[model samples]
Every structure is written in C-alpha cells, then in structure tokens.
Target: MLINKAHQALTDDVVKENFLKYGNPDGPSDVKHGIALPKFLIDGPSSPFLVVIYILMIAVILPIFVNSWWDGVKSYTKLGLHVDTTTYFLEYLLNYNPAELITIEKIIGFLSHAKEFKLYKRSLTPEIVQKLLLSHINRTQLSPSEEQLKLQVVAIAPKLIIGFLDLAATFRNNEVCFQLVETHRCLIQALNPEANATVNKYKEILQLPGASLEKLDTTQPIYTLGKLLKKPTIDPSKFLNIENTKEVLDVAAQIPLIEPLDCKFTVPGESYVPPASTSHVDLRFIVKSPAQKSKPDVSKLSKEVIETQLKDPETLDYLRNPLKVVEDQPKMPLYSVPPYFPDVDYVRQHSGWVAFLILQKDGGKLADVPNYITRVDLSNLKLSPAEFLESKAIVSAYKFPLSTPTPNVGTYHFRFVLRHLLYFGSDLDIPFVMNIENKPVETKRDLYEIEDPDEDSIAGAFAQMRGESVKKFEHEYESSDDEDADDDEEEEESDWSDIDTDTEDESDEKK
Candidate 1:
C-alpha cells in the first residue's frame, strides 16, 4: 500500500514537477526557528504551573501601574507644584500680617518647611526646622547640628527657587516668576551674616558684585542702583577695590531704570471721550540705561525739543503700537556661577516686568489681571557708559484698555505700577486720572417754528408774498370769530333775562 501511494504521488503533475526539480515527491518543507522547550514544560504539569505564574505577575504589576498613575494625579497641581508644597506655602502666606515686618530669616524659615526639601535630604523634618526657627527668633545661637541643617537648606534653596522659576516660565506665570526671582536674590543676600540685616535687605546693592555691607555703608548711603549711579563724586572704587568696582559698575550698567516722560488716559482717535465710551491708558517712558560710574546730567534737549520729539511720527507710531513683539527668549543664565549657587542642572533667567493698574480708592487692589512686559530693548547695554546715557531714550509705552466703559462722567484715580520681574526697588508707580466728558444736550426746534428768510433772496421774496397773504387771511378769520363770540354772549344774556321774568310772574300768581 505504501508503494502504491508513492507511485500515485509521483503520477500527479504538480508533485512530479516538484520531484523532478528537487528530487523529492513533496514540496520543500518550511524551516521555522523557535526555542526548543522540554516536553514537561510544554505538555506536562509544569505548563499549568507556568500559566498560574503569568497570571500572578500580571495581577501584581497592574495594581502597581494603576497606583502610580493615581499618585501622579494626586501629587501635582495646575501650577505643576506638589499639592502639599502649595498648601504649605498658601497657609504660611495667608497667616502673614502686613503690619509685621518680613525679614530674611522669616522668609528662610518659611521656605525650609517646603516638602521638596525632603526629596533632597531625608533627615530634614518639621520638628528640626521649627526648632531652628525658634532658636533664631529667640536670638539664640544654632547648635552645630542645627547649623549644618541650616547650611543644607540654604544650599538647596537656589535649586528650589530655580525649580519654581522653571514651572512659572512653563506656565507663563509672570507674577510667580518675578516673586521667585526676588526670593532667589534674597537667598543669596542672606548668606552674608556679616552684613547688617538692613543692608542685606537692600537687594539692589547686594545684587552688585563685591558690594559688601562696609562698602555700601559709606557716608552717602547707597541702597539703590540709581543712588549708586547718581553719586559719582562718591566714587565706588574708593570703597570697593579697583577690580571689584569694575565688576559692580559693569553689572550696574546692564540694569535698566525707567524714567517716565508722560502719561495720558484717552481714546485712540477721538480728542474727547463721551459718556459711556472705551479708553486706554497711554504710558510713555524712557528706559534710562545705567552708566558705569555715574549717569550724565538730564538730556541737553530743552522742553520744546522733548515735546517736539514726543509728537514725532515715530513716537506716534510707538504710541499706536504700544506693545513690542519679541521673539521667544531662552532661559537666562545665573549672573553668579557655582559656589554661589549649587551645581544644579537648571538655567535661571529674568522673565520681565509685571505691569498692572490699581484703583487708588480700592485700597490699592489690582484693577485687572497683570500684563507681562518681556520686550524691553536692552541693546543699548552694549554701548559705552557715556554713549548709553546720551543715546536717544528707548521710548517704550504701556497701554491698559479699560475693560468696562465709564458710564458716569468724572475723573477716575488709578496708580499704574510697573514692577520689575528680577529686582526689587525698580518699580514705577505713577498716579493718573481718566476723565469722561458729559454728552452735549441738543435743543430741538418745534416743526411749526420757522426762521424768517433773507429779504433780498428769492426764497425770502416768495416767503414775503406768502406771509402777506397769510396775515390778511388770519385778520379776516379772527374778526369773524370775534363777531360770532359777541352774538352768542348777547343771546345767552337775553335768555337768562326771560327766565328771571317767568320766575317773577309765577311768584305773583302764587301771592
């Protein structure tokens, strides 16, 4: 039977062709490479055991993934901050009293409580931090252990601040980023214990390199960058060494100071705003580029020149297009390198200023959500100190569109605050007023009342002819109405007399 079947296979045309081509009755077998497992694993009791192991693995891993996802969802907020960390900050800030002075130590203590520190140092705890703060508040010296912990916190602070700045930038939160920058600068200032607390508080001078408490504590009392630049006679080099002085001046030159030229609140095209009209605040300001050692005297241009410049076509164009469009800026590098700040893999940069309007009567509360000013032209920094100061002022303008119309006509008092993002003491608060004009009352004439036309003109001639005819007809009509009214009165009198006579006759008959 096997021989018969083999002969039948060879007899088939397709099989015969395969046999002739490859010397085999059947087509070539497909070669599939796979792992060779033991018979016991594939078909024995071990197979069911392996299936059980697989189910167990999935059961364990699935929960872990789900738990991880849930934890992530719970951990972060919309601001990209840990939920607990934000809660702690909110609680700390909420309890703060405006009357109570906020010191660097208090700020540090507040920051030390942040939960992010736990990720860096497991040893730091609330109890330890509370003790550290209590001791400091009591004016007691820190123990060696406490001192070490404080150092660790200080070291970690820049990284925390940088992280906050990163998150602020990512979220495009200008106010938060500005606050974080100020905190970062304050943290740097806090490192110098030798500096008096008051002197350390002056972030403006402290930001300058080699500007120690001693150098800044000179007779002139240079607390601000403007003060430092304005007083050239009190040479900074005299107090700060030559090399350090140069560094201070160079950095100072880079810092910008805003000198407001004019401010107006008005509608764009119209000269006056009627009641219930839209208007915007126009703030014209020149960014005073800081001089290395000292700023030059006020611009040589007279008031007339300045006024003429303000009305220039270019200036008008700037006012029309107040907001300057800037390309996306890369993160700024830390002015101070390592040893000052930890070697964190992060870049620190100034975002810009926060411009806001505050109603003076509303207890200085914000009138609107703040706008971010990221496009201040700083190309003037590259110029020489003298050239920079003398250079044509960078006329930047800020416009705030009043959201709601002024229904009632009156002046509204507002304070325009231009706060710096990276530095303290560089804010501009200019008070301005907006007036809504009263709408004019229109006196409409009655349709029947017509003015007499000119006598010499054709219209006057026609009106005169028509007027003569109208007056003659009015006179005749008035005479006829008068005659009719007299006759009616006479007839009524006669009727009354007849009634009286009849009453008298009736009385005589009764008698």
Candidate 2:
C-alpha cells in the first residue's frame, strides 16, 4: 500500500508536467486516479521476509540501472543521436515509412564500417559517411512512389552528407582522414548521373596497391618527375667524318719535329798518334740520333745511300779486286800466314758507315757545312748511310795505312752526312777529329772540363750546319788535331772557372 501511494505520487508529478507519452500529450496515461499501481511498483508479497528480500533486490539493481542509463545517454549524445530511445524503436517497429527506414539503414551502414570508426568506436570516415548518405538520393529513379517521397532526401543529401563528413573528420582528428573528407566533398559535388559512381571511384582508389594509393593525396599534384625530362636528340652530322679535324689535331700533336742526331768518335778522343813500328792504324766511329721524344714514321722521314770517300786517293784503290792475277807479280814470294784483306764489295754490302776519308785538309765540308778536318793519311775505310737511318747509330772499324814508316803528328778529321727527306733536304753533319803522334798520347785533361755535357748545344751546333744537299750520303773514319787546340782552350777555361769559384769561397771562409 505504501509502494502504491509512492508510485501514484510520482506518476501525478510526471502528468502535471504534460510530458508527451507515446508521441502525444493526451495519450492514455499508465497511471489513473483510482487504478491499482502495477506489480513492479506495489504487488510485492506481504510477508515481512519476502518484502525485505524485494527491497534488497531493488537496492542492488536500481543503482546499476541508473548507471547504465546515464552511460547510454552519454553515448547517444556523443554519437549525435537526437531521438529518444523509446521513440526510435517504436517508429522503426510500427509506424516507420520507407524514407525514414532508409535513413536508419544509412546510419547502420555508417556504423558497419568498423575500420573507419575504430578510434572513435562510433565514428565514420567522411568518405564512408558521404557514401552512406548519397546512396539513397542517387538510387535508380525507376520507382515513382519511392522517388516522389524521397525527393527531399535527395535534395538535402548533399548538404547533409558534407556536414556529416565534416563532423566525422573533426571527431577523428586525423589529417589523412580530413584530406579524404575534402576529396570526397569534391567528388560528391562533381557527381553526376549517379552518386554511386563517384563512391565507387573513391573506393577503387583506396583499394589500389600501396604504390598507387600514395597518389591519392590531393595535396600533391598528379605528375611524374621522369615525365618532365625529355630525351635529348643526337645529331648525326657531328660524327659524319671518320677522319675529322679533331683526329688531324691529335695526329699533329704526336709527330715529332725533325732534329739533329748526336755523334761522337769511338776510337780516338782528341788525338791518336800511330806508332812508327805499326804499318796500319784502326779507326772506329759512332753516330746516334737524339733520344726520341716521339716516335714518327721512319719510312716517311728518311732515305738512305752508301758511299766510301778518302782524302788520300793514292793510298789504295778500294774498287780493285784482291784476287786479280797480275802478270808482273807472278813470281811474288809466298807468305806463311794469309793476310785478311777485306772484300770491299762484301763490306759495302754490310757496312752502314756514311763516309770514308783519309784527312788531307785542315777544314772541309761534311754534309755541306764548315768543319775542321783531321790531318792524318788514311786508306781502305768503308761507310754506309743505312746505319744512321735504321739504328740511329754507326759504329765501324777501319784499317788505314801509314804511307810513311813514321806517321805525321797532325790533326785529322772525317765527315758523315744524314739527309732528312721529311725536312726537305735538311742535312746533319757529324764531324770528328784525331791527332797522329810519334809518342803515346797522354790522357787529355781538357776532355773533363765541361761539367755537364749539353746535348741540346750539340744539336743546336748541328742545326746551324743545315743546308740543301743532294750529295749521295757518305760515312768516314778520320783523325784530327785541327779542332783539338780550340776545344782544349775552351775546356781549360771552363775548368779554371769552376776551380776559381771554389778557391775564392775557401779564401773568403779563411779570411
């Protein structure tokens, strides 16, 4: 009876506030002035123990119920569900129309995408929410009844979809999702014929492979870096000539300029004196090209010839054959040992000497240049020009007869000419001198006076000797003292200067 009165009092208070029931204020009330209260409020067993048990059950359950109701209210507020829970179910179960049902279906569909709402637990991505809302508006217009009824839904769908997507993006607080929202808004704004097409395109983009999906960011422009670079065209004219000017320049850089070769006396220094007891003297000479800085085509640079020359033509006839029988010498005495007389023809075929001379003059021309000549009488010296062209060096031996029992103590010289075809008749002269004496020749101290031999100076000296010469090239072995005196003086002066400088330094230190 107490519970009944309490329940009645609560219902009267609710009625006086005119709270709508079942969606209408004048609807039949659950509580009436004389009506017995329902069992839930007043129909408990009247026994003391049972009544206490019921009170205990209510005590425990009421607070739990209140807590759960409060939580549901909070959840509904957060999800933006403005309808009362009871009315939401009542309309759907009994009096709901197709349009209303479709809205409900869309909300359900929005929640169905758990992945988009995983963080918010009830949120939807703008893309998904926009898709959910536009599906109903852009449906097939085939059914007139459906189309007429939902024209409003279609008219408002765009605005509402945009608003819903914005709310979803704000709720999620994700920059990528916000970008997606903007993209979906643009797609929806541009949607024509059917909204589903844009939705499908958005889905296709999202469902693409990882590499393609990266292009979905609207913040970046759609362009490939590789596309900006065009392929460069290669012109054929640049390489048309196999032997171009560049090749000519490269070849010109490699051909060495013609220069003079250095020559030296191998057998005699400044002088050589034949002993009175000896009937024959031997001579040797060497001619060498300069150390090549660049190798050139020798075939183009050189031409060769061979001839033998002697200053004393009466010494012997080189053109005479030794084996020729003479009627006047038929009774000549037989020798115990056979003499080795050189076959002039054989030596001429093999020797590379350019000139052969028995010096008789103080000065003469070698390759058409002025040079001091050796003063010795010589014979049977052979020469060849091929030696200088091929080996760039000439080393030869010759036996020359001393006409007198005792040799004349005098200067002698020999000359050799190297004609360069490449240089247009420029010729190099190799001149050397020797001295003949009755006594042993002393070591010439003047030879060591030049501290460093200057090969360039030697070449330059020969450069001044250049002349146009068509003479058949010649080789020679000779001896001379005509140049020795001047050379000795120059060398002595050079040595004296070196000695004087050292001596002056020492004197200064002592002082």
Candidate 3:
C-alpha cells in the first residue's frame, strides 16, 4: 500500500509542485484528482444503441428498480418484527466507494507479506476485544438497538484488565509495567458501569467505606488517555464547595433566631395633622411586648387565652411581630364639602389602608365618625408562613367598585376603622379630616438598592459607566507570548546560521 502511494505521488507533478510551494499539497492548491474514463470509452468508436442502452439503464432503469425495492423494504421494516437483510446488504454494497476495488490487490499482497513477519498470530484476544468493543460503545453514536447489542457484548466479555495484568506479569518485577496495569484497572473501574458497581459492592462487602470510583482523578495523564477511549468519570464534588465545620457554623450564626410575639400599640408620631390629601397617613409607633426568657410554645396552647403573663418588666418579650387586621370592615360614610365625586379614580386616589374601601354614609354623628372601628379585612392577602415572617403585611390595592350616588356633590365623611390582628387586642383609633377634594396621590415606593443614589455615588457611577473600557487590575505575569515568539524566532535564526556554517565547512572539505 505504501509503495503504491509513493509511486503514484512521484508520478504526479502537481502534488510535488504544491508541496514545494505551500509545504502542504492539500492546502488550497485547487488541483482536482479523479479516476480517468475507461480506455475503451475514450479510444474506441462510439455505438449509438449501446450508448443509449447504457445511459438509460444506469440513470433511469437502475434508480427505478432500486427505489421500488427500497420502498417495499422500508414499509415492511416499520413493522419491526421483520426486515429484509438482502435489501439492506444490497444497499450497503451499492453505496460503498468504487475506490475500495483499487485497494484489493495491495491488501492481498500486504497480507501475504505480513505472514513472513508473523503478523497472523497478532489477533486480538477476548480481553482485548472486549476493551475495544466497550470503548467503541462509550464513544460512538449508536441507535437504541445497536446500543443494547453493545451493552450485551460488554456484559458477556471477560475482564479486560486481567489481560493487562497477565501482560505485566510477563515483565516480572518491572515497577513501571505493574504501575501501568494498576492505572488501567482504576480507569476500567471508573469507565465501565458494571465494573464500577461490582467494585462498589465488593468494597461494601469488605466494609471499605467511601471507596468510590467517581472520586478517581480522571484528569491525571494515565486516566485521561484511558478516558479518550471510554466514558469519563467526572467528579461532581470538584465543582461543589465543601464547607468545613467552622465555616458552616459561621454561616448558621447569620440567620435570625428570635421568636416573634404579638405587640401593643404606642402613641403615633406625625409631622402634620391630616397630612396632604394625596399622602397616606403612616401611623408609625413602636410596640412593647412582655420580656420572656424564651418564646412560649403556641402549638399546644389554646386559641382562647394567653397561657401565661409576665409579672416582671425585665422578663418581657423583645421580638415584635407586625400587627395585622383579622377581618373585613363595613363600608363607611364619606361626607365632603366639594360633593364627594363617587368616582372610581377619586376613591382609589383618596383611599387609605387599601385592603378596606370607603363607602358613603347616610346618617352618623360627626364625633362618632372619628372613633368608628371594625375588623380589618385580610382575605385578599395570600402568604406562606416563611414569606409572611420575612416580608411586611400590607395590602396595596382593593378592587371594590365605588358606586355613584344620586346626589352630584355634597359635604361627606367616610368613617374609617382599625382592628388588631389578635383576638385579645383592642381596636385602635386614628385621627383624620373630612370633606377633602380629590387629588393625584404620588405613590411612595421604596428605592431598590441598584437605584439608590448613595449606592451609585460619583466614584461608583464612573466605575459602572466605563464598563469593559475600564482597565482591570491583574496580577503581573512573567514571560508573555511576545517574548516566547521572539525567542522562537531567534532559535530558528541560530539553527539556520549553524546549518549554513556546517554546509560551508563541508564544501571546503570536499574541495
């Protein structure tokens, strides 16, 4: 085969020219090579009948015949229980390259010569065959049935590493060969699922805990070369951060451990009484709870009563849980001087404690309006215990409709109420002014960290705005690529100079 290739290459001037110019005959030479037409076709006189028949048979008749067989075989094969092996075999043979026929003589000659070198005895043993099949199975793309066959082949095959061990034994007391065999054994156990499972089971039977094939360092040279021919054993723990005891304890310390307690309302502070019509009157105050040494267990306690009371102020609870209203309040009256426009937009803009809607009142004393109270509606809110604990309990919207009254405009007062979340807690009173005009309320929203001016101060703002253009600080590196390239060029120049000097000396000696 080698001799034939060399002879053909030597005969071809194009290949030689391309190699001299580009150092690569295959590189963009634009030379096309092909088998020439038969000598008879080119040299002999043409026959019209034979030509017509040959063209017709190959281009039309052959395709039609093949297509008919293909269609029939394909349709029948879809049943899966039966298939035409002859049709598939015919297809395979027909599709094979015609160039293969040219290699037959060379292959026959090579095989005849190979026996003189004792190459016939170099057949693969069962162990080596098993390894090759398993490696092929791990790397090749196979159909479901083909994969099943490969797996079955792997199952029936004998242990492959045993063959390597036997080969190693022949080299008696050779440390390198034994080491290589051991490496192969480790890699085989890592790549082969059946082998790995068997190893694990054996380890378990021997009480060898934590002996896992997955933990093998597959990146090492011995394992990496083996993995190229088989499936890789990737250690997932390499990507995971394995925390130490101290680090874990430090992380746990950051979490809040306080148990929450129901709180009592204190006096609310305000900058302005009856704040701007648009602004919500945020009645803020700190609540006090009984100081207990530990949180009371509410799981076994009755809903009707407090299990115990704190007699000492020093033993009062410190953790304050946010207060929530338990139920819905009846619609209240709205008396306004500007003829309270019973419009949805107006009502929505003016409403406070959004979970409850304000309704128009028919008859009520002006004094009773301020003190009117009912259970706050909490039906709209849906929250899990963890989320409720983490986040604030505030409803931002109420979808109730605001009905237009018969009267166009009049002085109105909507009685608003406040209720405690706990059954034992009392109703709280809040002060407000009546008969206000509708105004566009600027909604208050807490700024996200990214939007905060303090976070994006001048220095931070400049850093972010520059993006990738900003030069990043990197640790200094030794011997960059430019230095390496320069060194390589110098080495090549030196080598050429040495060669030139040797040639000149040789010429002088010849003279």
Candidate 4:
C-alpha cells in the first residue's frame, strides 16, 4: 500500500517528463527529470524505448568504425581498393589479361602450366580442379551484388572480367597472373618489334643485374691524383740532402674554378674513432710565412741556375708547390696546399687541427658567404642533407673519443667534414630524358659514373681519387723533421681558406 502511494505520488506531468527524459533519454531534460526521483529514475529498470534508441545509435556508428578499420587492413588488397585515382596501375598490371579468370580457369591454367611434369606430380582431376576453383573463387570472381548490379556493363564488355582477374591477381601476388605477362608480351611484340626490343633491354637489365650494377666502375678510373693536385712526387732523398733530380712542375698554366668524412678522434684520455662527415666553403689561404719558398729568393744562383742546379726532379717539384697562387679575379690560380702553416698542435687544443683546416670559413676570409660544411656528432648530421646544411644549422659540433699513436695523455681529436653544396639556379630539375640525335641516351648504370668525383680543383681531385695510390707512407713511419708541416702525417684534412698561401711555408704560420 505504501509503495502504491509512493508510486502514485509521482505526478503525470513528471512521469511524462521522466519517460521522455530518463527512460527515453532523448536529451538533457531526460536525464534531469528521469534521474530516479528518489530511487533510480529507472523505476524498475528503465523503459525499453530509450534502450532500443541507444542500441540503434550504436549499431549505426559501429559499422563506420569497423569499415574504416577493415579498409586499413585491406589497404594493399588491389581489387578491394582500386577505384581509379591511383597512378601506379601502369606498371603494376603484371599483364593485361589475367590467367585465373574463373576458379576452373585457374585450375586449367595450373594444370596446363606443367604438361611436361614428372610422373610424381599431382595429376589434374575435374572434381579437384572444381574444388580448387571454388576455393579461390573469391579471388577471381566479382562480389555477387556488384555483378548483379553491374552485370549489364560486364556483359556488354567481356574484357571487364579479364580486368577483374588481373586486379585480383595483382592483389594476391603483387603481380598480374602468368596469363597477363604472356598476353602483354605477345601484344607488345605484335605492336612494334623495335619498340619492344628497346623496352625488353631495360627489363632484361632489371631482371638480371638486380643490384650488382652499382658495383662496376664505368668512368675513367682516376688512378693518379698526381695530375690533379700538381704536387710533384715527393722523394725522401731530396729532403735529407741526398742525390736528387729536378722534376717537372705539375702546375696547370691556368687556374680552374673548383668548388668543393672520416674520424679518428683522440679525446684527452681516450681512444680515437670516427664517423663520416661533409663540409664546404671557400678557403682563403693567406701566405703568412716570410720564408715562403714562392718569395723571390735573394741568392745569386738566379732562376735558371736554381732550376738547372737541382739535379733531381723531386727537388724542382718542391719549388713548384709552395708557389704563390695568382688570384686575379674570375681567373685566379689556386695553390696545392696552404703556405706559412701553423703547428697543428697550436690549434688542436683550442679547436681540433682537422676542424681548423677544413672549417676556418666562419670567422676568417669568405666570412660573409654562409658556410655549409659542418661536423656531425650523431652522424644524423651527415646523413640528413637538408637539416644538416640548413641556414638554421650554420655550424654544429659534438665530442667523441679518439685514438692516436702518440703517448700524450691530453690528446683530443674530432673529424669535421664540409659539404660542397652546389647552387646553380633558383630551381633544380632531375633530368627526365636527355635526348640526343632524336634518341634517348639510355644511361649506362656503372658505379664509377654514378660516383662522379669532384673535378673543380685538380689537386683536391687527385688527392681524393688516388689517396692510396702509391702507399706513400708506411705504417708508423715517423717524420724526420718536425717542421715538415705534417706531409707524412696522413693529410689531417683539406681546406679552402688557405688557397692564397704556399705549401712549404704553411708550417710556420700556425705558431
């Protein structure tokens, strides 16, 4: 009796609100009024109208989310995804006509594929073949609904079936079935033999070489860097006052405008190691030595006498290098190496000798032209080209452990590579088809050609191409004179800032 009274106590207006709000849950009013007057507005459990409404809403949304997930799952499935906006279908067709159009067709093709099979191979039977067809019918056949709706179109154009099979096969194996490959090959041959031959040539190479084509050298193997640097062949005999011959100077009459990573680090108390690096910028080689061999010698022997008196070519070669570079604008001659050099140890402490040589562009001459070369620590600097040379990255540095033959405990080393970023115009375009004589020059894919070395500076080019040419320095061969400017010291690095100096005088400038 009390429960009945309590239930009756609820007004009809409120009950209506409760039904529309709580049980029905159509909006905010539903929750406020329907929320258990005192108990759970869900009086006995809630009305079924609201429950059915919520269930319908969920059913409507669930398909959308599931369909999205399924689309992702079948992203690579061609037949399921192809709807015409894709641009990759040209070469992906495998063949124009697919072999496995129907399940029986596929079974027939499979059986025919091995007519000459050995006796142990499974023999084709109609029942087995029919079952196989049924098994893969989903792959080769169209969805019934789609076929039913689009049948008129498919019937009017029978080739549509062939296309469906091709698309399906592409999804299955990332290639058109065998029927397509042969059919296209035959059609291609029938179309034009010459064009077919040309295409076949590239296909042959692609199928044959795979990746080994990158290994073969095709360019003129630059064997001797001696020609590039114009540095006379060095002979130890000339340096120690032994018998010598005057050598021909490797100087080019004209200076060619040349534009241009390893690490053996020696941290104060650690072993040396390395990473690949790149850098670039002008090297202003200011002649800093009073003893620059290029300076006019005040000896009475004179030019002719000095040239001839040097009985050995190696001796004459020495005079040619520390030559004062002629910097007459638009046509300046570059030096082989810097002149009036400083002791590497002098700068190795404040900065690394390697960095100083290759990275003197920021504060010194050519200071205005933004530098592009930088030292990479994680090697992410070396690998990522855009971020590495961005204006935001004028310079970057990192410290790593290094090793040296020296016994010094405070040794520190770092390798800084400079990248020679070539700028030609506002925009650069990849060569699509370099045509000549009305025909394409099908580029020969030789590694040497692809690995074209820098050819701007003769000396730099020579050094790069023939660094290990003659095995010039033996392992652990100590320099006889500490003042030799580290010639035998593994060429710490190369830099452009010292173009105006002489090689021999470079040693004295550092200290």
Where does model 1 exceed 4 Å of error? 1-57, 92-104, 126-184, 188-203, 214-217, 227-230, 264-282, 292-339, 342-347, 385-391, 398-409, 436-511
The candidate 2 region of ten consecutive residues with least summed lDDT is 332-341
| TM-scores for every candidate against the unseen true structure | 0.56, 0.16, 0.15, 0.16
* lDDT tens per residue, model 3, 1-511: 7566455556778866665677655445567974255757745677555567778988999999999898767644322212332243223334544345322122112212221112213453434333435453233346776555444433222122223223323332123222322233222222222334443333211111122244433343222211211222443234111334233222222211122232221111312222232222223221111111223343433433232221111221311211121212333222111111113333222222211223335332222211112222332123333333332222221111122221222344443333221111112333333333333456577665233333235654676675523334343578788988998999999999999999999999999
Candidate 1: tens digits of C-alpha lDDT, residues 1-511 = 6686479566888877777776666667677974356766768867877767767767987889899999989887765667777776666454645566544455456567778677667877866754553443233467787776665665566555554544444443344444555565555443333235565455576556565555454555666776666665477777454466776676776666676767777665556666676666766665554553333334654465455434333456545653321222222333333223332342233335667767777355555556556555555446665664564444555566767675578877888877765555667879987777875767688998666666656777787888732222233344677788997999999999999999999999999
User: Which is superior by lDDT, 3 or 4?
Assistant: 3
Which of the numbered candidates is closest to the native, going by highest TM-score? 1
By summed lDDT, the worst window of 10 consecutive residues in model 3 runs over: 333-342
lDDT of 4 by residue, 204-281 (tens): 111111111232122322112222222323431232122321211111111111111112222121122122211121
lDDT computed for candidate 4: 0.28
| Number of clashes recorded per candidate | 0, 29, 22, 49
Best by lDDT: 1
* Alpha carbon RMSD to native, model 3: 38.7
| Candidate ordering by lDDT (highest first) | 1, 2, 3, 4
lDDT (C-alpha) at residue 288 in model 4: 14
Candidate 1 vs. true structure, TM-score: 0.56
